[model samples]
Target: MSKNRFFACIRSSFFSRLLMGVVAAAITGTACAAGEAWPKEINLGYQKYGPLIILKSTGELEKRLKEHGVTVNWAEFQFGPPMLEALNAGSLDFAVTGETPPVAAQAAKGSPLVYVASEPASPQGEGIVVKADSELKTIADLKGKKVAVAKGSNAHFFLIQALAKAGLTLDDISVAYLAPADARAALERGDVAAWSIWDYFYAAAEIQLGVRALANGEGIVNNYAFYTSRRDFVEQYPALIDVVLDEVRKTDQWVKNNPVEASEKLAAHVSIDAKILEKALRRSNYGPEPLKPEVTAAQQKIADTLLAIKLLPYQINVQDAVWQPKGK
Candidate 1:
């Protein structure tokens, strides 16, 4: 062959190999980026009622996670406090609860909890109730009277706000720290003058026992539901966090759009009457939202209130525990 042609051929071959090398590296980089480190399984905590229950019942989240080879393990709790306790104990990777539990959890020493997302405030969903014929007509009437409430739960915050509006504090009232069943029984037996609680417990009381609410959270407190996870879990598996929140958002929309069907599904799991479940569902606000600045401020107010009342040991910045994805 001619010398010029031999050299030309070598140059062409070298350029072709370089182009292939660049394309191969780009493909490998894309694959690595796509194949993020996802856990094989995740443990989720849920209460008997709420969007989480809806999500669990429909099995939509399970089906989606299954596609990623991630199995879901669900753990149930009666209320927010215990569910959050499990999260703090490392038994749950993710969970959702009402406003107060996250505040209490964040205040606890060595808690690994972080606020990942929140649902809209459903102020009318919880309240303080008295017997239909009871003399307690106003919040002011509760002074020195025994009131049943779940300690460290959302109802606890509601009771505080209620009492404060009446110029009373926790010290002025006799607080019987009891679970929902015991509280209901206490209210029925006249052992406590009133019971402060959230629905479907509130709905059940109204339906089955003819109890009357002195005041719902309408003007007293913003009863927000929050989704939480361990700080490490959020940091390590941010993508999983997005997946879970997306499912929760979808489920919330479904519940809002079809309340009757959602209530029936929830009633089946909770063993409560579908009618009562529907009542509670109607009062609740659906849709999961991120921790916006305004939300953080509202949460900060709860923390400050708890601190002022000595319910919390020390002051905490609610924003400190908020999770932020890579770019806003």
Candidate 2:
């Protein structure tokens, strides 16, 4: 879909309701105070996913915050780990990442951040893939074979969970820590027996690389995408965080109502085929849900799982990083 069609689809009752909801949610002190020194610029880090892609393509975030004299700077990352690193280092005020990055971040010393919101579970968003002719027919078959995954990424946890379910552990496999690009190459070259990754790269590999998925996050991992901010940033600019999530909610509905065009726009953003993008987006759940008790529990489960596997240096209380909105 062209850019014109993408915007044209926004003119509908769904978007109308979404905008109304955003306005209602933000009307209550969600804007910067008149004399308050609102940061001159807000840096947002994102991957090539649905909500961020749509928000960037439409330039809606900049438009929304323009009235408050806030400039929106967009930085794209290959995956969540480095994005979260940027968030912790003060280069980014806000970012979205898969469930595992926060655990990894909190585990690392000197990286203080908070989970403000999250996207619903997207179990189908990621999986383990092997070449069509590979003999790795099951997770158990991965024993003694090379598997590629991005270190400290959501896929890393997925791989660990898959191995544990198969009565195997990381020691059972020859693990290769590679980014998505390198892992895709390794799989194509038969250097790795399997590759663990998430969409849209996962979908692209299946469509273009002829890989077959052996197992997905279904019943294996919750696969929630988390929205995070540096602890100090959130403390200082609670209203900006609320405004950003408000826009996130609006973009979430926009994409759900127009998945096809949304796919097209994301494809253009990431330089992937729209068909592959569509396959991934159609299965994804979008929105910025509050970090409620259930969500915190789910995150805590992930943290404990990581600690059990010795991936984390020490035990962590996931609630330590949860942001408590005023009066909540």
Candidate 3:
């Protein structure tokens, strides 16, 4: 009722309001730091390759990712280059692609797309494959012969190398630029005497269509899949990438040890039959190694090959694009 009492009461109320505001601000700041309610969902791109297909179909990757509160969202692409494109466009957090697409994408996107891991080349290898009954036995055999291979694909590199090894050139071969599906049909119908392909399809033709492997690009060079993530992703979530790499390690070993059963696991995902995959499984080297200098050198060679062949706009600085493996 007194003037001093009224002023003192008003001051106390003001102080209490100010203190509440500060506490609310601190809580809001804390909320922002902790990120949104749900953990991020990792979008992974793949191209129906056996190991990747198996990784997805068997639910191993999803199970592994769930532990981190990261849900696995799988996106399938037609080829490695497209997968890498999706990754560069920010639609994908991680994806699998061959050695060349990342190089070309990194050059085009200017974003540092680092190779987190790689599935070693198939021991039997990818190449300019042809029907068994067909007469195309070598790259020299491809001269004036129509060859079906995916353009800008690692198969493209295989054809180039196959041509070079046999003393012909890309100009010598009549390249039938087709997607993997059409390419398979072209080879089956004898529309194109040869088809350059990898893994399942390559094996499918061998079993069903009686195709023969004309050349081996394993020890030579060809499209080997890479599990790649953005450099920014690694910086922000280093441990997440490590978990991915660790999962990759576990799966790669499983894929190698159990061949027949693993092929059966991949049957549903790929176009090729399980029998074909079983045959092709023998060729694949699924053991993962971190991107090493020799590996980069091999990839750089493919990039250079593309540049020299005029498929790419220009050569990319691959060393900078590559992310150092955490193990080292």
Winner by TM-score: 1
lDDT of each: 0.91, 0.88, 0.74
In candidate 1, which residue pairs clash?
A: none
RMSD of each: 5.8, 15.0, 4.1
Candidates in order, TM-scores: namely 0.89, 0.88, 0.84
The true-versus-predicted C-alpha distance at residue 228 of model 3, in Å, is 1.1
Candidate 2 residues 1-328, lDDT tens each?
A: 8988877877776789999998976664445332234678999998876687678888888988999899999999999989988888889999999999998898778877899998999999998999999877899999999999999899999999999999999999999999999999999999999999999899999999889999999999989999999887887688788888998899899889998988888778778899998999888998888887888898898889888878889999999999887666
Model 3: CA > 4 A from native = 1-39, 268-272, 325-328
137-184 per-residue lDDT for model 1 (tens digits):
999999999999999999999999999999999999999999999999
Question: How many clashing pairs per prediction, in order?
Answer: 0, 0, 0
Candidate order, lDDT descending: 1, 2, 3
lDDT of 3: 0.74
Best of the candidates, lDDT: 1
Model 1 residue 94 CA deviation in Å = 0.9
